[model samples]
Target: MSVTLEKVDLSLKYTAYYKQVKEELFEGSSDILNAQRSKAFQSFVMQGIPTRKNENYKYTNLHPSFSPEFSFAHSKTEKEADLQEIFRCDVPQLNTTLAFVYNGWFSRKSSAIDQLPKGVILDSLESISKQQPELLSRYASLADPEEDPMVAMNTAFAKDGFFVYVPKGVVLENAIQIINLMEGSSDMFTTQRNYIYVEEGAKLQLLLCDHSENQNNYLSNSVTEVFVGSNAELEFYMLQNQHNKATNIHSVFVEQQRDSRVTTHTASLHGGLIRNNLKFILDGENCEANMYGMSFLDKKQHVDNFTQVIHAKPHCVSNQLYKNVLDEQSTGAFAGRIHVVRDAQKTNAFQRNNNLLLTDEATMQTKPQLIIDADDVKCSHGATVGQIDEEALFYLRARGLDEGKARLIMMNAFAHEVIQEIKLEPLRERIDELVDKRLKGELARCHDCSYGKDC
Candidate 1:
C-alpha cells in the first residue's frame, strides 16, 4: 500500500521561511541588492506557486511534489569529502578550465582556472559583488520576477552562484566548465543564481553539468542571465544527470545584440522531476539564435521543456528543435512559443517538437505557438508524436541485428540530429555515450553516487 501526501499551503510556508532567512542570512548585504530581494519576495507571495490555471504551467503541477518541511539553508555542520575524486569530467581528452558550485555556493577552493586571459573574469557572484559592485548592479535582478514564480523564488533566496564576464575583442583559447555538485546529506531546498556577459567581438564556449553525490530527496532551483553584445558568439551546453529522487528547476534568459550568434544545447539524461525554461530575445538586427534539446526519460520520471524566442528587431533569425523519448510510465512535455513584433518586418522563425513512445503507458504533451504581428515574416511550427516504425525495425532485424539492437539504432539516429548541433567534439562524444547508455536502460545511477555499493 502507498501513502498519499496532503497538500500544504506553500505560500504561507515560504512567507515564514523568507522572514527568518532575511533576518538571519541577509542582514549585512548591500542595500540595493536587499531591496531587489524584498521586491522579488513580494512578487512571489502575490503569485504563489503557479497552478494549472496558468497557461504556461497548465500541464505541470508542483503542489504534489513540493515539500514544505524541507530546510531552506545549507548546513555548515555537514562535512564534505574530496570533490576532485567525486566530480570529474567524463571526457578524458577535454582540456578545459574548471569551476565548482558546492551545495548552491560557488566553491573557490575546489575550482581551478589556468592562465585566464586579461579581460576574462570568472569568479563567485558574492565575491564579484564585493570587488566589482558595478557589474552586479548592472545585471543582477534584471529579469522580471513577476512573470514566473520559480524565478521569483530563486531571486528572493539566491545568494551565491557563478559570475562570468568576457570583455570586447577577446576569444578564450579553452572552453570553460562548471560542475554543480549537490552534496545532500539531508532533505534540502537550494537556490543558485548565475550571470554571464559577453562583450562585442568576443567568443566563448561553456559546458555546464549538474550531478549529485547522494540519493537524498532534494529540490534545486537555479536561474541564469546571459547577455551577448554586437558581433559576439556564444555556444552553451547543459548536461543534467542527478539522482532519481532529486527535483530540479532551471531557467535561462538570454539577450542578443546586433550581428550576434548564440546556440544553446540541453541534454536531460536523467532526473526524477525536471523543468527547464529557456528564453532567447533577439533584440538587435541581423542576430541569430538556435536552441536544441533532448530528453531520455523512463520509469516514473517527468521532464518539461519550455522555450520562447522573441524577435524584437528586424532581420533576425531563430530556430528550435526538441525531442523526447519516453519508456515505461514516464511523462514529457514541450511548449515552445515564437513571437514577432510589428516593427520586426524581416524575421525568420521555425520550431519543431518530436516524441517517441516506447511503451503504451508513456505519455507526451506538445504545443507549438507562433504569434506574429509583422506582415513580412516567415514563421512555421509543428509537432509529431509516434512510435518506432515497424518496417524499419524489421529491416534492421533481418540484417542480423537483435530486436533491442535494432530499436536502439533507430532511436540513436532519431536523436543524432540534435546532438550534432553541439560544437565541442569531446563533449559531444561524451554525451553520445551517455545517451546510448540511457536508451539501453543501463544508466540507473549517477557516476559519482556515494552509495553505489548499496545497489
Candidate 2:
C-alpha cells in the first residue's frame, strides 16, 4: 500500500508543480520550445515516469530514484566561472574545442564558440532558436515527445541547452567537447533540450562528458535531436562519470539522409540510476549507422541502456554492440530493438549484447528484438550474460602471472573488441587506460575530471 501511495504522490506532485510554475517555465524559454509545453505536459500527466510495467523499462525499477524530494528551481545565479581551470582534461596531446554547461545551462565562457569553423554555430537553444527558429522547430521533436513520457517531461520543463550547427560543406578540424557539470547545495532536478544539425557534405565530431561536482542527489533529464544531411559524417562519444547520488537520463534522436554515416560510442564509467535512450532513423538509401557502448558498474549502481534503430529506407545498414561488466551487487539492463518497414527491402541490421558478472550478486537482463515487415531484409540479434570464461582464466594463470593479474588480463581481452572500434586515437588510448584501472580494482580517474588539476 505504501509503494502504491508513493507512486501516486510522485505523479501528482510533479503535475501540480507544473501547473503552479507553468508561467515561470515560459519566462526565458524560446517561443518554439514553449509552444510544445502544453501538449507535452498533458502527455506526461497521462504517462507519468515509466515503471517496470512498461515493456521498454521492464528490468529497471525507477521508484526510489524519483521518490526523493528535489527542488526544480536553480539556487545559484552566477553568470560565469573559470570552468576550464576547474575541470581540465588531463590526457596530453588531446586537444579539443571545449564548451561547458553548468547546471543545465550553456556557460557564457566557452572558448569553442569563436574557434569553430566559419558558418558553424555553438550556442544555447533559446539563443539560437530566436535566429533559426525554423531549423530548431523542424528537427527538435524528431524523436516524438508523445511517444516517450521522459521526452514529454523534458520538453515541458527544459529552458536551455546547447545547439550545434555545422553549415553545408564545412568540416570541423577539432572535436567539439561539451562538459555538463552539476553542482549545488541542495537536492535538485535539471533538464536539457539540445539540437545538432550537420548539413550536406559536412563533417563533425562531438564529445559529451557528464560529471557532478558533489553528491547532492541530482536528477537530470536531457533530450538531444540530430540531423545528418546527405553525404555528411558524424562521430559522437559520451563519457558519464558521476557520484552515486546522481540520476542521469539521456535520450538522443538521430536521422540520417542519403549516403550519410554516423558512429556513436557511450562509456558509462560510473553513476547511480543512469538510463540512456538512443533512436536512429535511416531515412535515406545507402546510409550507415553504427553504435557501440561499454559500462563498468559496481556497488548498488544501476544502468539501463535502450536503443531503437528504424530502417526506413532500402539498402540501409545498421550495427550495434553493447557490453557491460558488473561487480558487487550492481545491476544492468540492455534492450535493443530493430524495426524494418515494408518498403525497407535490402536492409541489413545486426545487434549483440554481452555482459560479464564478476560476483554472484551481480545481475543483468538483456532483450534483443526485431520487428520486420519486409521478408527480404537481413537482420539478426543475440545476447549473452555470464561470468568470465574459466578456461581462459586458467590458461592465463598457467602463463606464470599472478591470479589478480591473470583475471585483469582476461577482462581486458574481453573488452578489447569494443575499445578497438573507437576511431579517435587519443580518446581510445585514454579510455583504454581508464578501463584498465577499473578492472584492476582502482579508481578509473575518468580523465581526471573529478580530481584537482594536479592529479
Identify the candidate with maximal TM-score. 2
Local distance difference test, candidate 2: 0.86
Error of 1 at 18 (Å): 0.9
Q: For each candidate, what is the lDDT? A: 0.83, 0.86
* Residue-wise C-alpha lDDT for candidate 1, range 1-455, written one tens digit per residue: 12221223666677778887786556654454466788889998988777777799887777655664677653222236555566665566777788888878887777774457896988887778767888876643446799998899888888778988999989987888888877665777888888889889899998888876665776898999999989999998988887677788999999999999999999999888899999988989999999999999898889999999999999999999999999999999999999998999889999999999999999999999899999999998999999999999999999999999999999998899999888898888878888888898886343444543431
Off by over 4 Å in 1: 1-8, 74-82, 139-142, 444-455
> Model 2, range 360-405, lDDT digits (tens) per residue?
9999999999999997999999999988898887887888888888
Candidate 1 lowest-lDDT run of ten = 1-10
Q: At residue 15, what lDDT does model 2 achieve?
A: 91
Clashing pairs in 1: none
